[model samples]
Target: MPPSSALRRFFVCPSHRAFTLVELLAVIAIIAILAALLIPVAGAMRKKARETRCLSNLKNAGMAFFNYQAENRDRFPPACERSTGSWRAFDTLLGYTDATAELLHCPLDEIPRVRSLRPRSYAMNDPLWQRESWPGVSLNDMDNPSRTILLSEWFVDGNTTGSESYCDLGNPGTFAHANGTAGNVLWYDGHVSQLSSASHDTNQQYYNFR
Candidate 1:
């Protein structure tokens, strides 16, 4: 071959190298492994973000609660009335505390499914309000406000018989976050913190009505 032609052919590169079947398969396998590893990490990061947002929402709700009490003679809001489904006393604080209704929602909550029934994510501690046998307690009634849980993330279902629209934190099964193992609990003292399932199960007194 002419030197010039050889040089031109080499420079132009009429043909190209292609990946071998094994090499291609190996590349695909590597990609699959990387995706598998990254997927869980990404999911965990998203969950953490949602948890942080939910905590912030709880903090806003806690402030609303305090603001409501400041105007209402140091009393907490009434629980949802089971008979007429009249009004969720907590919802009444929306205007009083300069809080929007959206602030009551946890980002992790299943919005579409529960929006019609329980539009908000946080719930009131039902035991804080007087019922038949349950004695109503005020914010002042709490001896250890720092240790008590005032509000938390709750899952509400209105389809069930005798179901109320509002979340009643009096239930032991009530969760604070999406994991169902831990919750973002708002204390009467206006501090919000994460309460693990283990801690909640061990200490029922903090959640109970005084």
Candidate 2:
């Protein structure tokens, strides 16, 4: 049998095992502080992720536009054009994929009801292209794809008059308030990007490259 001293040592906990209440509280307080510091960062990260996803949605929509153009002899949809009574162009592409909503919308929008139907956070600038002096102006005529605003978030109405009606070709930006400063924009070349508050003007300039 082991000695009594050995048995006692084996059963007894070390002094380190017993933390004081103050020490335990201090550790918990530090953890709480760390969590508080990370909460905003985590939220920002989540927002960025959502923005990336929205951009991907725009890319898909851009592809859908190209496909539609291919099928329709290079003719693009009207900026405010709908199938008699429907959402914007994004709705027309719903048959292709499920990410159509992200192309039309941002994660920061407040109107849940609006998003629930078409799930879009952005609109197309087809109306601006409609005013072109020549026929079949085409998206390629733009000086720079990065500077152009092909897709954006704008106000939706019961009558379906989109904000793109106010936009213009070669000058692709709008003062629409449907989405906040940190909104997603899809370029003409099927690429999506994020626009910042300081990047674009009140009208979201054409060549400003927001």
Candidate 3:
């Protein structure tokens, strides 16, 4: 009644096909090494994606400004605050802007504010502080909209007089890429440009309306 030795020899058990401990350990080591190499790359990719999103948001805001002019008799939207608190102008224009918090924030911002209504990554120039004015205030009304700053990631306090600010174009503060590289600037013309370290001088001709 016992099974024949020939049958047992012909059919090897499935358990015998399993990997040996050494082989399994080798495979695990290779996987661990691969993960170690890929983790950093994946992190960098994520950061770049965030930066791209930030730029897109800025472009949308710039486009919105031009659209605002079309509806407001060729005058750009008012700056953040001309006579009131930190963001009264923006608050008033909420009906005009998409008012979505994400549109106002930049991924490179270290202190991006998230509000109950929306989050903000950048701040608009204050006409009173930034020297930009509408037709009623300046004879240069034609130039106001063209010269006004639409959006910026500059969140630092510097020697810039009035409301001018400097932005950090570098990676997250904790990373080696933290050296200030380039910042995103959305001009009144609805154009976006990346400025480098030497270009950090926003007062320079490149950033100025000149």
Tens-place lDDT per residue, model 3, 1-210, is: 877998887786746578999999999999999999999999999999988888898887766655555676655544532232245334544556775645666766664343432446655544422322444122133254344555555554433453343222221121112355656777655677775555455444223442
* Candidate 1: worst-modelled 10 consecutive residues by lDDT: 160-169
Provide the overall lDDT of each model, using Cα atoms, as 2-decimal numbers.
0.64, 0.56, 0.54
Best by lDDT: 1
lDDT of 2 by residue, 1-210 (tens): 766998899999978668899999999999999999999999889877875665566677778777766766676555432333244445556655555345555555545443224444555565434533334336556666556777665443333344343322222233233255555666677776667756644244333232
Between the candidate structures 1 and 2, which one is better when assessed by TM-score?
A: 1
List the candidate numbers ranked by lDDT, top first.
1, 2, 3
How well does candidate 1 score on lDDT at residue 208?
Answer: 46
Clashes of each: 1, 10, 3
- Model 2 residue 195 CA deviation in Å: 3.7
Residue by residue across 33-81, what tens digits does model 1's lDDT show? 9999999999999988988888888887777767777777777667666
- lDDT head-to-head 1 vs 2, winner: 1
Task: Rate residue 23 of model 1 by lDDT.
Answer: 98
TM-scores vs. true structure, each candidate: 0.66, 0.63, 0.69
